[model samples]
Target: MATQNPPVADIETAQISSQTAQAGSTTGSWANGAFQKLKSNLVFRSKWAELNGAMGDLGTFIPIILALTLARDLNLGTTLIFVGIYNFITGAIYGVPMPVQPMKSIAAEALSDTNFGVPEIMAAGILTGGILLVLGVTGLMQLAYRLIPLSVVRGIQLAQGLSFALTAVKYVKQKQNLPKSKALGDRPWFGLDGLVLAIVCLCFIVIVNGAGENLRRGCGAAREGSDQRDEDGDVEGRKSKTARVRKIIFSLPSAFIIFVLGVVLAFIRRPKVVHEIKFGPSSMEVVKISRHQWKRGFIKGTIPQLPLSILNSVIAVVKLSSDLFPGKEFTATSLSVTVGLMNLVGTWFGAMPCCHGAGGLAGQYKFGGRSGACVALLGVAKFVLGLVLGSSLAHILNQFPVGLLGVLLLFAGIELAMAARDMNTLEDAFVTLMVTAISLVGSSAALGFLCGMIIFVILSLRGWTKDKPFSTIWTDRSTPEQP
Candidate 1:
């Protein structure tokens, strides 16, 4: 039966080839698509989105904490101006869109137990920014990052997380007290009350988690069946599912609802402490500094902090390169040049020293931000918040019960810290921990970086580790003995 080759064989071969081609095309498309999406979505388009999202999440809370800590000690108006100017300059220049609202730690330093006013701190930030700009321009910043190792960075992150967590706990305890001064002229501690509130909040979070799980399961089941349909239909179905998920995750309405609930809870509790906190004005006078003060601010701010800022910038470039280009050598010197230039541009207008803000970047990625658009959206939103809130937003935050703010901040800090867990290797873990520790312990991020680098070098030299260098590494290994 010389029935030549069966027609089925030909068809089978053709199908196999088609499948291979389809797979190759899909993989290529996905790679291109993810990159394109990242560039356009988060970095470019979502600047305003990130800004607004962060503001709604914890941007507002950060400033308020600073205000409360410094209210009795500093000129609220002056502090507001300082923060506003710094934020404006940084946002305009570095394109890193993080909210540089006043930090609680800075406020604590300036307030001291004794009376030292906002002017000093404002002076400090201005000085820091100026120094950072100069260093960045001069290329000192790059050197700093190169010196630090991955282990130190990890440590720093871990320490920072702990500090943030402790801060949250302190605030929660403070929130429980009655507004009235105690017999000893000290504020009453509300530790017990805070614990209860924390529990309740946790319960609420749990409920939300359950609801989310149910929603995901339902959606997945729907998608699985829908994919069996015609090609066009499946595509449309997938789009619909994506949109639904996004709506659930980033919907302003949902946030508003939570906010409203918070407000209602506040009213019902009528926490007395809210009334005691001094609030800043909704508007602030823009003080034009005399050239002498400006010069002083620049000198004082930039000179001391310049070293740290540069190091931070270098670390940022290294981290970004590793993430964006795995298994590829990235030039730390080039990254330093780019960041330094950006910092210089930012400091011209009194902006905060801008760096990679690894924590912020990670959060954006987790939240589905992909491109520059996402980052840009964040910037726009921050600008708008600054404009709309003017100065009063800081005050409004102070008026909220401390417990409420504490809970919110606690979650945010945890989220930021959790990013460290993503670093799989021991060396990476060490870097994060060291960076965090240095930032917290020294209260100087730059110093922490320096310490981290020393550790990394020691580990590397011992041959206990193997990781690519940010710049380049040359090694002399004894030639293997001839076999």
Candidate 2:
């Protein structure tokens, strides 16, 4: 009997596996070989760009962490330690600025209830992690990745980015009686992280980001239609005044600067933070879970996060990674396995449950992170903080300006939404838009995903009414135009 060819998706998966194995086999130790591969790659450059990019996801990261630590009494030191290791490992393997973030649904449920403590959080993480591991190990994640339409993925990205932008705008805009906010509406506009400082920070980040893109475009344009000799010539005019200005701007590391300023302001606001700081690591222990706690955690946290994790964490992250770094490809199975392993290993010690996020990836890319070094640098910082200040780091983070985070989140959100720009067809665009609208209005990505899949199936069946086969309808939209 003639053997049938495995599907294209299968072939792609096989290629990824082979490449990784080849890379790992190069050295005596697999770990060393992977690191050696990363060392030889230019995309892993550690520079000011990495510094700026490292802070890109912090806008979303800090708030959720603060909420988890301050609200639920989770072991902050242990969380950072594991997340730090995860960052470096993810950066090393992926060769891009992959992000590890707290599960939003889990964070929300954990924060809203006073009764939801560390044990429940750990239970939820274990359950979610176990399911993801099974999905990845059994190859079900790869199958799901192939089946989900690209339009639906774009919709998820667009909706998430817009939602973040909206939330950021709210953070910028001050309201009376909201003392928990970083900036007060009643304060002097020019005083301490109020509207004026927020606007200034926003302007600086926008200018740096815009100027860098312009310089890159100019260089690309100069290289176009050039002879071999001309191409060899310095296209970016190293000595030019304009080039110097662009270099200086990029070197400023706006996100890092903003973050440091926030920390300073936090210290100023709460001088007692210095005295309260204990110079040691927080103890790590497996949170004891009751049978009731497991059920409650699963129902309250895992169930809400399951669809979000499936759609955003695994599928969307894989899709977005490919789009952002065309030279690099990521597998949904790999991402699922990593996320699953992260929570299973860490949450036992009361660490926050984490996963890959598209919004975080977009944020890093927007902030000049073209390489894995950006995340690795961030990992180093987290590692140091965990070892030194530990949970006391939360003291400063608690007072970290909400307005600043809002500014950062605003840009990250917009950046994530821009990933949907590749949509070239009307029906596909409409489907993406409708899904985004439903997600934002209904306040649920799962709803958007369910509706998107249903709408996609219905729209896809249009050709079937004319006696078209299912494969024709599937293939027509399955191979979307690449940007």
Best by lDDT: 2
Q: TM-score of model 2 relative to the true fold? A: 0.83
- Name the best candidate (by TM-score): 2
lDDT scores of the candidates, listed in order: 0.46, 0.82
lDDT of 1 at 253: 25
Candidate 1: deviation at residue 96, Å?
A: 6.7
lDDT tens digits, residue span 298-325, model 2: 9998998988899999999999988878
TM-score of each: 0.57, 0.83
Please estimate how well model 1 matches the true structure, expressed as its whole-model Cα lDDT: 0.46
In model 2, residue pairs whose N, Cα or C atoms come closer than 3 Å (at least 3 residues apart or on different chains), thus clashing, are none
Clash tally for model 2 = 0
Q: Model 2 Cα RMSD, Å? A: 10.9
